[model samples]
Structure formats: structure tokens, C-alpha cells
Target: PNSSKVQAYVLSRKMLDKIVLLASRAQLPLEAIIPEDDVWGDTAGELGNFLLLQRSARGHFRISAFVEHTIAFHRSIRSVTPPLTGVPSSELQMDSLSLELQRSIDYLSAQLRQVQLHQLKVCCDEE
Candidate 1:
């Protein structure tokens, strides 16, 4: 049976992969869809323990739950070192990323709306 940490890791990776696939279909870069911190966490938390998704500034998303687990595990395993540094601030370039992601989602939504509108028009014309 898989450990809780392992399960969490698998779940997190699967979710991230799905997000990437969806973003690609939408013609958006994975970076634009997922925050750098989250990717970093995936790397740091090799055991697949602990994952979190949160919103950053301007509604941009962040992935940071792995860091906490990593730190805790390290402390338990060995002597703790200085806290890892350089977490991106909630405001760090999030506005731009948010705009990009939002643009992609909005474009897709608009396209769908246009198709629906066209279908309605066609049906009305047929009547």
C-alpha cells in the first residue's frame, strides 16, 4: 500500500499534469498556467508528500505546499539548516501571469459563446 505522502505526491503530480494538458489545449504555456513555486515544490518533495494550491496576487495561482513538508522532513531526518529563502512574493509578476492565463481562458470562453450564438442564429433562421 502506498504511504500517505506517496499518495499525496502522486495525486499532486497527476493534477499538475492534467492542468498542463488543459493549458496546452488552450494554447497557454504551462508556466503561465502554473506558478514556478509549485514546480519547485514538486522537485523538492521527491517523496510525493504534501501539496497545496493557492491563489496569488491578481488571482494568479501558486504551488507551495511541498516546501513546508520538505522542511519538516529534513528537520526530522537531520539537523535543520537555515530556512530556505526566495519564495516569490504574492505580488511578484503575478499580475502579468494572471492576465495571460485569464486571456487564454477568456478567449476560449468567447469562442464557445460565439459558436453558441451562431447555432442559435442558424436555428432561428431555419424556423
Candidate 2:
């Protein structure tokens, strides 16, 4: 996987550009634009249990999960409906989030089963 491409896709392009511009003005290295969340967090494995959730309009939401101080998954879903006026209704958003959570759990369970099966096969072969 191309990390540069993944970072560009995951982060907002406009925000990255602004960070680059500021770094240039301050005569700082371009690497300054990258976040340092991993440095201290990795030392103590403090980030392993972190689960960040961001809610957006209607059914839109983003969930980031970290495991063993590494981001295991990051997902964002945007609502398909037309833009709403003012804030989106919380009840509706919760419902959407709940549905998505169940779907994610089911998917994860399926993957875990596959991993267990592979491990079992490997163990049997070794014996």
C-alpha cells in the first residue's frame, strides 16, 4: 500500500495544503505537517484502546479504531440525502450509527472466524 496516497486520501487536501504553506512560511521541514500522535503514544501503548467517533449530518459518521497503538480501521460514511438546514436530528443520526455499528461487528466476526480457522489448520499441520 502506498502510504502517501493513503494519507492524501484520508486527510482533507485543503488542510494538508494549508499546513504545508505554514511550514514553508516558518522555514520548517515539510515533515512538520505530519502528526506526531504516534511518538509518545507508542512509548506507553496509550493509543491501543482509543476509539474516536465523529458524527455528521443525517447518517454520516466516521469511526476510527486503534489496536496495539496502531489504527486498525477508519471508516466514514456520508449521507445520501440532500443537505439539511441547521443541525441534523440526533435521533436519526443515532439510528444510522447503530445500524452501521451492527454491520461492522458482523463483518469483524466473520473475519475473526476465518483467522481462527487458518490458525487451527496451521497448528494441526505442525502437530
Candidate 3:
């Protein structure tokens, strides 16, 4: 019965085209375009304790969760970290990051409700 069920993934044609073009640019074989979240989740390994944060060139933030090295979920939100203005420190920026982090976590939780995932390890990309 379980073997009879087919697994499907929802993808956008536009994104697939982009992946193809990128592969062409790099002269690499076009195989598949797995989302970054899947990779992050895989790195999480067994124990479900890995998270990743990435900053976009346009000042946005993206987050992903992993459970037992499997993708739990991911989302993109407005920037949490503020731009550096040569100031040594700023409480405002810290507060903003804290609030945004919490909000992102909440969003992730809601998304993961359909599945099971846990842990608290985090990995972030430094720009």
C-alpha cells in the first residue's frame, strides 16, 4: 500500500527555467533544482537540530529548518539585521533582530505543523 503511493513535489515552471539557464551557464548537466531548504535539512542530520539563515543581496532574509537531515520547512522575510552605519553598537538593531527572529520562528512553526520536526542548532551565512 505504501509503495503504491506516489510522492510529488510542487514547483514553478519559471524557477525550473532559471535552473536550466544557470546550469547552462556553468556548463553543468541539468538534473534537478532541489530547494536550498532540502540541503540544509540534510546537513542537520539525525537529531533534527539544524537551522540556516541566508541574506539576500537586496537586504532580505531567508530561513530553513531541518529534522533528521530532512527538510521541515523554510521562509523568506524582510531584513532582520540592519545595515552598519559605522556605529560601534546600536540597541535598536539588536532589538529589531530579536523581534524578527522570533517572528520568523513563529512562521516556521506554523508551516511545520503538517509534519514533525525539532531541535535548535542554527547556521547563518555571513555577508
Candidate 4:
């Protein structure tokens, strides 16, 4: 991601319309559409500076940094399964996750000079 990055949330017009229609039929107010990462970032923001490392699925990890009660830096890392293995070993998974997580922290630090990270949180489903 050496190239300059711009963070944006995109929802397809057709899907958004469908959601709105569904809500209207259900008499539910469709106030806003926020990405899941934004919710996580906002939750973490209450803790001041925070770093979240989450496992979304087997061999998949996501990292998020907060900004304006939303996600500032976010990236998903997928670990490769070792040869002849059905899934990545725990150690291999950790290595990939940590390496990407370090790069994310470094990127956030360089981008935001005052990144005084107050907390580090890790969430993974037990195997």
C-alpha cells in the first residue's frame, strides 16, 4: 500500500435500495448505513488510542485503527496454508498475522505522529 490510500465505504445502489425497501416494508427507520469496521472502531475509540486484531474466519485476520470514532486504518490478512496441510498451523497463522499487524501499526504510527496507543486487543475463535 505504498501508493497513497483513501479510505471510503461503498455500498452498491441496488443493494442499498433493497435494504431501504425492506426496512420500509417492515416500518423500520433506515437511518444510516455504517460499515462493520466503523462500529468496531467506534467501540474501541472509547478506550482512547486502540489497536484491534480480530480473526474473521479460519486463516483470516483483520486489523483496525480508530479515527473520528471510526476506522482509520484497516486491513485484512489471510494466512497461507502450508503445503499438504488442510489449514494453516497455529504457529504459521500467528506469524502471518503478527507480520501484517506490525506493518499496520508502523503505518499508523507514521501517518499519525501522535499515535499513543492505549490498548491492544486480540479476538480469535477458539480452535
Best by lDDT: 4
- RMSD list, candidates in order: 23.3, 12.6, 5.8, 4.9
Write one digit per residue (lDDT tens) for candidate 2, span 36-115. Answer: 33432253343344444444334445554444554445566564232322456556755676676556556645643332
Model 4 regions lying over 4 Å from their true place: 1-6, 55-59, 80-88, 123-127
lDDT of 2 at 50: 44
lDDT of 3 at 112: 57
Which tens-of-lDDT digit does each residue in 25-45 have in candidate 4? Answer: 999999999887767766753
Q: Native-vs-model 1 lDDT?
A: 0.36
Q: What TM-score does model 2 achieve against the real structure?
A: 0.48
Which is the leading candidate under TM-score? 4
Task: List lDDT for all candidates, in order.
Answer: 0.36, 0.46, 0.60, 0.69
Which stretches of model 1 miss by more than 4 angstroms?
1-86, 90-92, 114-127
Candidate 2 local distance difference test against the native: 0.46
Candidate 1 lDDT over residue span 1-127, tens digit each: 1124532333477887898888889997665544444454455333443433234333323322232323111111111121112553445344544454445345534533332111100001111
Candidate 1, poorest ten consecutive residues by summed lDDT: 118-127
Model 1 lDDT, residue 38, Cα: 49
Flag clash pairs in model 4. none
**Which residue pairs of candidate 1 clash?**
none
Clashes of 2: 0
Backbone collision count in every prediction?
0, 0, 0, 0
